[model samples]
Target: MTKNNAKAYWKENLRYLFILLSIWFIVSFGAGILLKDTLNHISIGGFKLGFWFAQQGAIYVFVILIFVYVRLMNKLDKKYGFDN
Candidate 1:
């Protein structure tokens, strides 16, 4: 790939990383800690929502984000003609 293409691809990859990481942080830290009390009022499968997020939800979200990132990168690679 040309220099410009490489720069653009790296830029987009960074953008994706930033956005995805921010989401994980929000779910793990925001919901799990900062808003724990409010979330605790709600329950999922008999477990407090905040507790669940702190223990399991955050993990699940991280895993899902992994797949999402992979799919996004695949599309990004195709867009830049780097899908080989």
Candidate 2:
């Protein structure tokens, strides 16, 4: 790719990276810590949402996000002709 195209690709990739990382942080730390009490009022399967998120839900979400990020990166790589 030309320098301009490469620069554009990197800019776009950085945007996506920031968005994904922000979400990861929000779900793992924000919901699990900052908003834990506020979320406790809501419940699923007899477990308080906040507590659940803090203890288990966040971990599950983190795992799923990892796979989702991998899939997204794979697609992005293919689309940008960066895949091996």
Most accurate candidate by lDDT: 1
lDDT of each: 0.96, 0.84
Worst 10 residues of 2 by lDDT: 1-10
lDDT of 2 by residue, 1-84 (tens): 678767877887788789888988888688889998999889899899888988898888889877887898788778778887
For TM-score, the strongest prediction is 1
TM-score of each: 0.90, 0.85
RMSD of each: 1.2, 1.4
lDDT of 1: 0.96
lDDT of 1 at 78: 99
Model 1's TM-score against the true structure: 0.90
lDDT of 1 by residue, 2-73 (tens): 999989999999999999999999999999999999999999888999999999899999999999999999
Backbone clash total for model 1 is 0
